[model samples]
Target: MAKISLDEMNPAMKSKQEQLLGKFEKESKTRQFDHYLLAQGLYWISIIVALYHFGTSFIGYPATHLHRSLHVAMILFMTFFLYPANKKASRKSIPWYDIVLAIASLAVAAYVWIEYINFINRMGSPNTMDVVMGTILILVVLEASRRISGWPLVILSLIFLLYGLFGRNLPGIFMHRGYDWKALVNHIFINTEGIYGTSVDVAASYIFLFIMFGTVMNKCGMGRFFNDLALAFAGSSKGGPAKVAVIASGFLGSINGSAVANVVTTGAFTIPLMKKTGYSNEFSGAVESSASVGGQLLPPIMGAAAFIMAEMLGVKYSSIVVSAAIPALLYYLGILVQVQLRASKLNLEGLPKDQLPKLKDVMRERGHLLIPIAFLLYMLLFSGATVIFSAFWAIVATIAVSMARKTTRMSIRQILDAFSEGTRAVVSVAVACAVVGIIIGVVSLTGFGLNMANAIIQLGQSNLMLTLFLTMITCMILGMGLPSIPAYLITATMAAPALVKLGIPPLAAHMFVFYFAMFANITPPVALASFAAAGLSGGDPMKTGIQSVKLSLAGFIVPYMFIYNSALLLIDVTPLVALRVAITAILGVLLIGMATEGYLFKDMVWPVRIAAFLGALLLISANVVQDIIGFSLAVLVVLFQFYWKHKKQIA
Candidate 1:
């Protein structure tokens, strides 16, 4: 593969970095937009729209003719000038095909604006050009989305679009009066029911602004601050570097919204440190994979999927974050506990304090920048500010806070660059979400969603476990090739009905699908996160991916737990019961950890391993009888281990 030095990045990434660096900037890695980085920007754009859509999303932004005209002009400018001219830009020049497509898309958006304005001027059926333009717009958006992101989303969208036209041809239990060109176009364009639906709206509003918030925060050194903070706190412990990577990766992932970036940033430091500390190449890679994958589930940002959930659920983003607090905390706890156990078992110590940045000093320098995050939450809960508004001002706060100190001030150029880059970032995600809307629109129009739900229920024959297993398999397969947010979007639209039919709550059903989608990152044979870590670790990529699945065992089990014990997700938590659920869940996690690790009070014998396995399974299920059996087995294993340890000590 062609390579560039750390100092010599491609023009686009360099532009992005410079954009982020603001006024008072130090040295930076000049990264280029290799194919991989181009792809990374595609993923990051998915996040950007969500940020862009922030303020206008809730307060109501009209598609005024003036705004539409301006919007089209800007899209054209961005595609032709801004995108093509950047030094680190992909391909060094826009591909002729993309240029043509970009121009065509501008024409379509402009046509839509004109037609909508005409419609407002006169009440009439859609004209031939309007219908044609609308259909072309769908095709163009889906095509652009595919060029940038991948074909999976495009294929899925096309299937749904086809279904809209052919639903009546489907067999019984899977049929509807299919839509036609005019109807489909009207639905997709004139109304906010298809392309410009909730997905795009969310992306263009709250999600985009929040992403800008992240971009600004990055300028102020959130990533570095997080890394230094992690090093200060965890670098002195057993396997400290890996823990630091995990902690730092999670923080970065929550903000950056790309696993590849997370790995490259933190993995460079942690992978070598892990190897130097005696962690096997595969294990170290697995650790990083697990950590990066787990980061999205962490909150304030909680991945793009969180905002999508709020949109799908028709709730404020705050509610999702509040509800997610416990589950996200538990997820981090599970990873931390596993890491600590592994370190203890192997006697891995931390990096020297002298080598680590001092925690106090690092915080002292950058603590003010944290105000935006705090302000964001306050705006969400107390101020009743819509997520978009909160995010816009949060961006303002990020810039303002950074400038409070001379070291972090952002110049006008830097702030505007952040805005421009932030808008560009949303292009892929916006396109992807727009295309995925085809799937949703098709499912909703054709009744395929309901039929599929019916089909799943029939296949399970009322057996919940079988139903869940099938759903899990489906989610993993879908997620393997697609980004989790889009994967979750499709799954929630199509597969969620199955569980809802089986009497699962809407939230539970969605969360179940979300977990499996995230787990796909570690599940071989297409574990991208694992592959990235493996590249750095010099380990067998496949082995690292497989080991990652094992190390991230909770990814498999946690979904099941929440399905059975909804309290795990705060589904019906009375204070007293919530406390009990938390306790049992922790024990359940420990039991499962011991079963998987094959150790307890002492190294477990094979027979005791069997008992621990049962114990873990039983408690993880969280039924009263199973809990009793689990406790009995777990206590017996611990007692046996204690006795055996004392005997060994005496010897």
Candidate 2:
């Protein structure tokens, strides 16, 4: 709420910002070549990649194999040049061996593109040269994934690769007819089912453009505008800075789609303000982590996974957005309620009105920045445009709309910078998508997906609730230390089918898996988003993760609610049923927040907290009988809290 100028920002805050951005950005840790000529060449390579994607998005892409191969090739080439093999490697130079690998990546990609027709003609059979190329490509993809996304995904991919090759020797349901090394490599590398599969295709076509759109918007100052708008709207309310974090981070994260990165970018500004306004370090970190993670659940551009989800389910992207709307709302509602309850419990006050920006003035200065987003939504939801078309137009609209205001307009150089940044930003996601394709490749090759689904179903003893529980656990485990895109992909490919086998609708099943996959960002043990927030807030990482889980309880629960009663997802339900589910779900989230924070009208006793928790769960159940019971319990708790507050006031 305090409008501090750039000069007034302290050294500590600046240092925190740099540390967080470096850690989350991934590319920042890459070796920066000291040779000016080499660095300039690398920069041009990134720009060229961006230009390639930009041109393809409008003019039509090449064959899936050709397009995806080129996309991955460019990503790999840049990645090797930028990211050293290890942290101990010199930061100011790329090792010579890495340069060789980079060249190898390009040669392999060129092979795929040049021989696309030849490879297709060969069908399922591959030559020795094909096998060799495929093997190298597989290694390239795995290493790229490891460098960009960390080891979790790479390790997971390796496990799947080993499984594919040796499953016949394994025990029980996990066993399958084994694939030979050559067969495995060919399947995972040379074919469409492997690295060039749907996930990578989605990344190349839809996700890249959207990422570019987001980068363009950011370069044009959209992030600053969103922050200012949030401050203007919420800075005068109780827990103003915290509320601003929820709103602003949610806005930024929805577009950015990387929970850890989102936390650092928005938390850098909001966390300090929240602390200054009386929020605890851990609480401020948790709030930003929870809110930023929720952005992946937000509509229009709900992370890279959403595009993959659309591709997997063969549904319109708009459908996923529509179904996701209510759950995303409830997730944030839970966070907001907890923040507000905490503020009241501590008697925290908002910043002085004079220190806050005026809403009208903020809007007048930067209101046009919102038009591109509005145009994007209109194209997606109303015009029924394809996701790629929507995003392409959105990018154009972003650049054009920026021109309306000199203060916000991006010059030609800035536009090029936006393109380069956008391309660089997507390297992690693209590599992850390519690597996960190997998992999917193996799953399809060895029937591992179906086998795993059956095994889960058997472990649950055919009980739907038990199956859902096991799937949740699996999702959380797989999602650990991984980004949401690959996490969701792995879970959706493996666990989601089990839920579908249990008679859950496909969309609901995938959405259920998707939510839990993303919830990992706030779950303990390896909560990336939470840790990033902790860095910004200067809080204990473990405590921040725990607090994040507590604040985001609704996200963990809403997936099950919608799975149980599809009306919550607006599926197979009347308007009345939809309304009832929506209302109950929102109220349930608020109750959960009160119970988690141990405050409502006043501080609650243990018994009241237990009752509130149970009631919240019941409300989310969406059963008429459960709803009645939950409502009665909630009402009783409210009455007691109200009376207790009154008595304390009198005292």
Candidate 3:
């Protein structure tokens, strides 16, 4: 076997990586200012925003509206300087108009607090100046979202705003009493229901701080530790590089919370390694993309959507994390099974042990990095700490823990850089949350959520299975081109309710939508994660996306399984039952992988493949009779495969 080097892939990988990120994730595409003044301004502004949020984690947030307002203001002020309005615009310096817009954004956000008493008193009826400021704030957010997230979010927000203003003229259930400009602006901007609603509230508090925690940890060499650790354990196994991608991407992507970023970060190394080890380009990219996308489904730092889910459900954030743990593990298991099976089928060997990091050595060298994560989990799950408190201390713990080794210790400059990066990392997400506030505001104001729910229920003819299917499609459509946080907020508002109306548990319904929303990153036509991976692996993007869907087939099914048996979610179940469900679910996912990959102990015939798939569905049914039937079918297939192999050998 040929030796594989990490640096052996495309020479222009970095440039391609940047191009792909810019293409699919506009939020990451920002100016690296050549002018020192503009650079310093962006840097300090980011630092101040990061520090403010960090401070609030201890000092406590201001009044809700004031806190969200300041968060949005800082976000907008930084966005104009960071993301240029046009590609042709200057990168070396800020344009004059953008500077004006920045100050105006700050002033508009400040107006709420300046007239705090009057703002509260005039909530029902804003004065002229209030309306003017509200209008400016709305426009400013729309423009900022445009620069950061591109036209999809901006256009969506505008449509919702228009619907709020003009839906009265429409016929049928969509119709509502339209609000004039003053009323609409007052409700959306002046109140906490629109731009300052729950979505922004989560972003302002939990999401931003968690993002900060991730960046700070990354600055302290956590990413390298995760990659090296995964390499140590998985890089000498069957389909080693692909398995490494799965493990490393899952670890990093969960905290980073951006599939595109995760793909570029881990895929740069893993994709090439997989290709060098004989995996097809499309399959390699698919593995990386699928794994990176699944990271958001993991915990304790699942996606930003998990934070929103906790807020909406009125559950402890730790509960959401706990419930997500099993299904997330099952998702990765399915991927790992298929990767191993593919390696077996192709007779591909693992990387030599000599070429891999020693697990013990890896643990000894940088094992301390895991301390902050353990501290976070303890605070969240056992200590019963507030999410903000846990996150703040986690950031502090990461810094303190980094001091154990000179190699990992963060200097003051590095710590400040982490703050700046953390704030910068959250820009697009924060903007998406703020804009989603418009959708939520419209849904609340116009009763569109209920109407949409009714429409989905009506379309499904009140059938639970059909309703789930419709909801899944609805989530995918709405999730396309949107960040996961906004996607979940929109889908949970519009689609999840339809499932709940059909008697699904509220958490189950929300999880259903959340699953599909995150999967949109690997769905074809607009699969940002897959496309990013393809760019790295030099594979066809659409093929990579299709492969990703196949590889993640179990993820699609897990939601439905949990919906059928809440025990899968660890809701209303005993420890024994949960364990039983988890074990069966693991078998079910592995069976599905075998069916998908068309291989098992030996090459699976078509009948064996079909039986494997049918058996998987049965095992996942979470019924005693069905599980028996599924297990029997699996055993029969195994025996039959052995018999066929013997007969062929005799021939």
Candidate 4:
């Protein structure tokens, strides 16, 4: 036996390493061509930048003077260095053009830095050449962002820019005198908004360190440990492996905070086991896609966007994590139930004991690895450190602990690899943040965020659900071609205020927007995670996407549930209320899984399934009248299933 690695058994996963790795081997040979080494250097460089920037700017307390130079540096690095590095070249090497581009980028930055001095000397006014160079730099940023995050954001930004330019010609409710290019550019560039505001601020600070923490953890066996942990916990029951995928992704999601990373990592293993156990290829892929795509909703860290959310709402990072506790649970509960029901439909059995890792043993060996994550939470809540400071210490703790055990210790080579990968991971986020900063800049300059919020509110006529639906639709459409962080940034900046107008709290509204941005990753037409799963499963990508949407039904509903019932979010929670919300949500998730998989105790009729869905919805909604209706209908469906089972057994 060649021993089944995560991907070899998965025809669907066979091409993934190639997709991710590109031409590293050949490129690794040369100094400039060495993508990995370059990545390594950049990672440590970022660490230094993070440390120096955070220390100098806000050691005693978080200062609001968000570093303009450092922030812009990260964006430019991602655009000209990291994003193009692997996709176009190598981790172990750099190409001549990369070096050329690098110098050019540096030159442009130098021009800005030097011009900044002269501008200060001349009473804050810059010259034409300075302005031209700045424009060129900003455009370079947008181009870089386009390469990494795709066109939805770029397109959205253009629309906003056009809105500002041609506001006077717009129809009723959308009319305003449009500004010229200079205003647009200045808003996005010269000010702390377009390339500099809260979006870029959070990115420069918290998001980067956490990303680095994930990188360190990755090399220290988080991937294998997470998989083994899921397998040990859930790999033995019917449909167990699929459930394992859900559980594993949900757990690892807290750290990686990236759906794409979660998908590629866990899908390589679990999707194959699903198919070998008789799960349909598309269904298997969908299961992985849905589960993995839940990363952005996972806590205590989510998509690195939660930190951003805290900054935007002006809340403590601890509060953001605490607020997220409930919704994240419901999200996973939904996936777990779906997996269990699917298992019932397929009649699959979990892996035999011989194949499973002993839970106690796995824990004994690697349990200390959990400390950094814990330390991170505690710091965010109590140490009074900024989120960036907390994440930096967490990264420090992760590296220090990895060395405690010989098995987990990073070799010199491994250390370099982790450093490299951490930098590599930030490329997309850094570029996206810069681009989104531009969007924010434009909105602020033109009052677009407020306008959009008011428009949505007026359109919904003060109806919360209608407003939510509209926001959801808009976010989904906007997120279709963007990364989760940037997608949420835009949503939080615009649509969230509309929810606030409708009496939703800022945290709840922003969290709601955050959830939808992630859902886009698995939504049809642009389900990036599902497409990855499809490649692994040898399944049709579109079918995989649609199935992913079906499997992840609870993801859509849970966000609505939380918005309605703050109790679910542990808002000023009591034990009784917590218990009630937990029970209702768990039951709701189970029913949802059953309805989608069309099985409970047995294959359900359309009527039974519909009843189950209704029951689940009612329970999830947490209203007394609806809960009663839902429970009664669910009982009726259960009785019907029992009756059919008894009849069949007797026959």
* Model 1 spans > 4 angstroms off: 1-60, 64-90, 95-97, 117-125
Candidate with maximal lDDT? 3
TM-score of 1: 0.86
Considering only N, C-alpha and C atoms within 3 Å, which residue pairs clash in candidate 3?
A: none
Worst lDDT run of 10 residues, candidate 3, spans 1-10
lDDT of 2 by residue, 1-651 (tens): 556422344688878877877786675676677899888888888899988988887788888788888888888998898888877888787778998999999999889777889987876788988898888988988888888777878888899998888789999988897889888877887778989887788778777887898899999888888888898899879999999999999988889888888888788788888999999999999999999999989986887556778888998877788788999999999899999999999999997888877889878888999899999989878997777777888999999999987889889999999998898888888888899899999998999889999999999999988999999999998888776777888899999999988889999999999899898888888888999899988899999999999999888888988998888889878888899989888878878988999998789999999999999989867679999999888899999999898986768
TM-score of 4: 0.89
TM-score of candidate 2 versus the correct structure, residues matched by position: 0.97
Superior candidate under TM-score, 1 versus 4: 4
Candidate 1 Cα deviation (angstroms), residue 451:
1.3
TM-score of every candidate relative to the true structure: 0.86, 0.97, 0.97, 0.89
**Residue 305 miss distance in model 2 (angstroms):** 3.2
Query: Mind giving the per-residue lDDT tens digits that candidate 4 earns over 1-651?
Result: 232333244443446634632221111122333456665666676555444544543454222322554456554654555444334455445557666665655566565566664644542244566467557766676666665665667777778778878987888767776777666655565666667677777666666667778888989877777777777777777887788888878777767777766776688788888888778989888888888778678778876777877788777777888778777777777777777776776677777767777789767767678888888888888888767667767877888888878767888778667766665666667677777887787778777777889999888887888989999988887777566778888888888888887888788888888888788888888777888788777899899999988877887898898888877777777999888887777777777877887887779989888888988888867587887787787778878888887886778
RMSD of 3: 1.7
Q: Write the per-residue lDDT of candidate 3 for residues 412-448, one digit (tens) a residue.
A: 9999999999999889999888889988988998999
Q: What lDDT is obtained when candidate 4 is compared to the true structure?
A: 0.73
